[model samples]
Target: MSTEEFDPSRWDGRDLPYIPGEFSDPDGVALHDDYDADIDPVTYEVVRHSLWNINREAGETIQNLAVSPIALITRDFQTGILTESAEFVFFGQYLQYFSGTMDIFTKWIMENRAEDPGIEPGDMFLHNDPTVGTPHQPDVALVAPVFHEEKVFAWVSNLIHQNDVGGTVPGSFCPNAVDTYWDPPSIPPIKIVEGGEISTEKEDLYRRQSRTPQNLSMDLRAGIAANERAKGRIEELIEKYGATTVKGVMRRLNDSGQESIKETLSKIPDGTWRERAYQERSMTGDDGVYPLELTLTKEGDELTFSNEGTSEQAGAINQPFAAWRGTILSAANVLLQPEQMGATGGLVRQLNFRPEPRTITAPDHTAAVSPSGIYSNQVSLSMANSVISKMMLSSQDEEIRNGAMTPTSAQWQCHIGDGFTDDGEYFLAPMTNCMMGSTGATPKRDGRFANGHMWIPEARGPNTEEYEQSWPILYLYVKEHGDTGGAGERRGGNGGKICYTMHGGEMELGVYTTDAIPKTPGLFGGYPGSRGETVVLQDSDVKDRFAAGELPTDITEIDGENVETVGKGPAIELDDDGITEWWWAGCSGYGDPAHRDPELVATDVRQGGVTVETAESVYGVVLTDDGDVDGEATESRREALFEQRLDEATTVDDIVAGDEAVEAGGGD
Candidate 1:
């Protein structure tokens, strides 16, 4: 395919089933194609199992070896196994976006570096440049090539989120960054390892850009070690099954995955679904709110996502193209084709992205994408989940409709702080309590309470003890935040709230976040999730109470000076004595709230998942003094609520309601 004939709009969805890109050059990928050999069913299945386990084990290798708290606690890293041509065969289930970038940028490296330095055996490359298709700068990837008989045979890569890289602020969210110049240096793929040896010159150059050089060194080792493990396993399998059979298995897995998705698409009706989300204040002192939209169209057996209504590249909340594509791919893999086992070459092959290259969802090289991990990526994921779920819900197949998932991780918030401990030790870290975000509602039932993140299925927050062991911060409480989810018959999951004060240190804490507008959308007539808030109490005497042997849990009772933070803000010095209270809301609900069951409402009230006041007002439920649901009062209250809605409603001619809706085929 020539550059003149190739069109991004009419992209072939089949390349993902094997190679993620077309073979514009080196169609053989520098060696002969042994994958064309006829493979027996037994050998293919065995090798397929081996390939999947290889990637999963690679992730375990990183998790066990990485010293980064983000990797150990939140498990916010990913690993992948690619073909000799950098086509992904199996990617870890941690962060789908990481694999998405790994696919794109590794191909970029192959296209650009094949001749100069060459793709050699026992060599590994490091990449995390947004301009070259990385989602963000902190998400560093290690890509290594495997050789069979002096020819490129396979590649193993892993990406992990670092706590901090050199930038305007700690944790590298960089809210003050107006452009890439102010961001952590975006490094493209470079040979970080040569002949199985760490390149000291390259390692020093990379480590010098991070605030926590020690941590960076350890994580780099972890990435290299993960690739080494995967490489070893691939070699062992090749030796056992023969390279031709192993390569045949990689080829066949993508073929089956692609066929599976196409079959599913053949059943569902084709249509377009649109979802919109908002983010307020790009940075501190910026009051403008921005709009981001996703238009997902299922045409025949293919899907195309377009960001037609999103805002232009501006401020610091913009993201690269890979983030948008990754969010969609994650949803399609989990909800549409979980059976594929992350052999997403086929799932991605069935999808296309009509990216708005200069928009917030697909910003250009000049944009500040450092904050994307917390801002732009979340909006894209939430909107993608919404649009994709709507498409599946409208399908005639019940299985497809039920496969629709609500938001897993609606948005990301970073409660990052850096300061000096009493012993004069420097500390920079993020309180991952926010990783316990709200899960979205499902068609079958309500969403889970702080279940997990959208993109990361295994996403979990660290234990309170873990933070205490690592830093001088004391958590007042990390508890369920009630009434934070949307109200409906099947309510959205509840979110979590964390309140903590500096104990034995002086810190500069900053809340770099999003969801000034709820990212997850409620389905049917369900209500949207509540917005998030970050508050700090200044000049507090909470320490005095702690000294008195009184452990305070309620933040409102131990208040001093309450300072609220805007969603977007510039770099600044915050009060050291302030206790940060973070409230991240939950996913959106499914169905109408007033029609919810009184027994469920009563149960929620008793369990602290919902307050009694909210049950009565939002759900129109009545409860007795003993906490039992009052059935007669609830019925009467529901009746009154129906009448009140009629009284307050304005007249409409085209709107369908009551028996008219039933006659118009609108009633369920």
Candidate 2:
């Protein structure tokens, strides 16, 4: 039983394993299954539903998809049809898993394509060049190619956000970067692997330019391992089903996605919805204000997401055409059937975009598109947010609401390498921070708090004890910053914190950040969440230090008071009082808070999400000390404030619905 022996076409076409109303085609026979064959008329009659969860999931995976866009089609080769299934993340965002998985595959494919092109079917490749396969350098991909009967069938790929790929800065994402050559280590799509073996020489070339070679190598290795796993699983699927059935299913899967898109297009009013907006970069690159304009033309069963109006930025903020398409398609899926699998290729036919190079969204070959030093993800999110705002005007989807939301993004990093301690023993230090921002208000709910990086999943639990015993670092404080969440139906969740002290031999640290000032905006009437910051400590005082600096030879945490900021000698505090606070920009609010439920307000207060003062000041909702809602007071106040506008008053049940929906929508 060799790994490549599976074929999907040999299955006896009896009733395949079905999930009733759910879609499942593991064996590839479903390629011929009529679209209406498993139909449940009652379940199919629904006209309105939230596709937020699915769309968000797709967003999470889009980066990974772009890293290995070509490899995503392999599921069809193995299963006899391309089933729109992707890996999942703890936060339920599909893009994260998709990107991670695809990253691994891209590397595998690049290594295998030339050497074991036939028998070694599950091999992949890794590269980051526009001419060969990918568009830019920061977006490195891991790809794997699938084969049937020694014939190449399909592929899988994943992408990761590398802060630096050579270049002038510690992180390669320099906003000031003008040309591709200015960006360091711009890897063209050359095979860094051969016959499943990674080229150490090539890897060394990458490490020479990267600030954190150990971290880069570790992450890259992880990606390769992930793709190997995908190859193993996909081959198993083919072995269980037969190649013909798998191929048929793969083709049918594309058909199904296209059909789903068509159905969604038909439901919307047959008119074009247009929106114009600009996306600003946090770090000013060679150019200023990388204006990203979006023009969405929804005509009947066809929709086009174009970035013709966008202006190119200095560096990696510029996205490739395929990557841009992935993001636009991801946003569109939110407005359509989010729960369905959005496979690559034909499923994206209905959605198209203009590929004018030199624009921020679709830059020319000479443009620097690395994301390490620049705020690339932020740029993409801003453009997507603009489109969402426009779509909400014609639809009831509050996810598109930009008024209540504030725009912000955060930067966090960890260092893991063979660092020596006092006794010269090897150690690894992983530092993670909560780079948070505001969120928009949903239809019936309040805005979410301190969420940064539309793509970052939750950080693993803080390793305080691990730091104390294994490494020479002090974990001073780790908690959520109070009053940081934005105001809305419920105030947004607060951002988490981290304070550490360095010791032993001098160690090098890397910090990646962006959206430093203007926060990522919120939707509806919800206010944006808090902004994020990173600093160092000498004594009890906070010190303004650059990321490329070295740490002291010894250090320790004095008290458990959880000092918010650290520095040398004098203890420096973050003066949130107007000056410093205003320095950190918050996104705008979404809808009106008066429309939120009083009960929900009470719960938020109990959970420490909203303070009594903010409740009174922002949402105009009052509560009792026992966390009970003052219904009479609430009703009268809401009525007076909203001028008897019923749409502004969300009931207790609605509040519950909104909260539940947020959890279901998949962000922590």
Give the deviation of candidate 1 from the true structure as CA RMSD: 4.6
TM-score of 2: 0.63
State which candidate has the highest lDDT.
Answer: 1
Over the stretch 1-668, how does candidate 1's per-residue lDDT look in tens digits?
11222254322111111113464445223753576469888878888988899999998988899998988789989999988766679878898777777777777777767786787888899977876766789998889888898888888888889877778878888878888888899887899998999999999999988889999999999999999999999999989988888988888787788899899888888777888787777865788888888888788888888898789988888887876777777777778888788898767667777765578877777789898888788778888888888888888888988888665445676677788788999888687787776777777878877667767866688898888878878888989888878888889888888888777767776544534666668888777877677777888878788789988888878868876567765433445566777777777888888978789899999999999999988899999999999989999988898899888887544476645543212222
Per-residue error (Å), model 1, residue 15:
25
- lDDT at residue 548 of model 2 (Cα atoms): 33
Regions more than 4 Å wrong, model 1: 1-21, 27-29, 570-577, 651-668
| Model 1 residue 517 lDDT score | 62
**What would the TM-scores of all predictions be?**
0.93, 0.63
